[model samples]
Target: MTSPQPAETRTQKRSAQTATLAEIAREAGVSAPTVSKVLNGRADVAPSTRARVEELLRTHGYRRRRAESTRSPLIDLVFHELESAWAMEVIRGVENVARDAGLSVVLSESAGRLTPGRTWADQVAARRPHGVILVLSGLDESQRALLTSRSIPFVVMDPAGDPGADVPSIGATNWQGGLAATRHLVDLGHTRIGAISGPTRMMCSRARVDGYRAALETAGLPVDPGLIVTGDFHHEAGYRQGLELLRRPDRPTAVFAGNDLQALGLYEAARELGLRIPHDLSVVGFDDLPVARWVGPPLTTVRQPLMEMAEAAARLVLDLGREDRSSTATRVELATSLEVRSSTAPPREGRDVAG
Candidate 1:
């Protein structure tokens, strides 16, 4: 008589042949209810019993009915738009985390809109991603509920709006960054500072503007309402608002822009008026995009650590996926630092740059 074959190998082969859940339960020497709990990842099952049942299911190749395999190694990334260098930075960060984990990223945009379309969530649900990382985006109640029900974890990065106190999210220190940017300008001896801000509805934008106010108050300078203008955080808005600010009789000697794109637009406005950087006027911006360094005079701006924030969000979502139930909501705000480049200096004495 031949020696008995290894039990696990024999079971593996049998599973490949076609084994029902009942058969797996019988082989694992557990009741069907216990086996069901293990299959569903229910916490009520004892560790040893769940392990035994899982081993049997793995060996027997049992596929749960009407459910996609939970082992999908794909991560979904949702963005408001992928057209900007800032967006590219975020993508690179997420990709770095995904590559290390032996996973791939699927990119989605909200139809070139800030708010996601209703069907976008449904499509994501259908894909059954292992996890999701949303950049400057949000989910409605139904969408959030759907993902939760399916055990798909997600994290928000630089959420466009308030992501709620209970939602997991990662963001930069926008308020601190704004304060630093304005403070840098003030330290350079420019008291008459103007600011072109991003959309007021976005939390990040509001926080940044608030920081600017805080810095001004700390320095004993009254916040000038006329000097602050709201824009959409684009080159056009920056150029338009920059022109308006520069045209004033008591033009600001230094201007703080919400982002790098807007800063470049300000550069154009200053150039049009024949004003020399750091000599006639100084400028500061947020989000030190690569273009900031390559400009005529490198931009003095706030470095928001976009890539690091994205990486953190991606890692958090994956970790949430592995956990049965995270006890508390997670929120992370990476520090933002000032990058002093060649774009700022003290106001010129005796003569107004705008004239």
Candidate 2:
């Protein structure tokens, strides 16, 4: 009804031929792949090539299609095992972060019996997730190489040392936490401190013991060789260690367990020996999990920032596609707090507090 608009000025008229991306690239003297790479902001393209393609895109008024890009988004979360409640907390952290950033998580658990590393690697390679997050402390060299080799952005939680790869790491400072727990007991004048540690291969076990030693030295107390017991990080190990320590003519007045799970075992050992806590013996633990607070006497222990660490790990892996390495290869050490309860006190019956 209004005057017929000319073809050049008609906004409603259908154009038979929509411009294709390849035609635009041909006009810019570059391949269609270059235009696609630059338009998508993929990291695989070199700086010069990316720049050239971007310049052409701007000149040609090319725009990125958001609908297609946002259609398929997924991430991968890998762990040695997922049985513990604490681990579940970390998982929740990861899920919260990823979901907020418009992503869904695919989970994998490495059985961790012998070739779990290689098997996990093959499985991950087959899936090709946008990014990966690892929660295993015992990750082997080949597995690390595979991740880096594939140019996949990954993050590791609770890495022991070096991490030996380009991935970022997020975890609580296990060593410092142990030191804090032991130092608290040492300050309370419990000189004979016995420990129930985890597996030797685990960095957590080694770091925690190191903290125990550091506290003893700081207090100018001689580390007692007979009092130190190495048990699995289970309650049974704690019970066995407790039995051995209680049998000594000079028994430890306080015990520092590697984890809360082991601390429960130590409590059983005290019951077996007819010793009263903070009366005849004292006990402290690491990883102040939810159960630690509910346990008898409300276990005095060190707490790890499980949620915060998980969030940081998630961010590191999610932001990997960005040009800046701001979030990649980062190492964050969260602080630990010591929760004092009725489990510790100065030795009784004229037992000299080792200083």
Per-model TM values vs. the true structure? 0.79, 0.74
TM-score of candidate 2 against the unseen true structure: 0.74
Residue 271 in model 2: shift from native, Å? 1.6
Superposition error at 145 for model 1 (Å): 0.8
Evaluated against the true structure, the overall lDDT of model 1 is 0.82
Q: Which stretches of candidate 1 lie over 4 Å from their true place?
A: 1-69, 324-329, 351-355
RMSD to the hidden true structure, all candidates? 13.3, 14.4
lDDT by residue (tens digit), candidate 1, 139-172: 8765665455455778989978888765799999
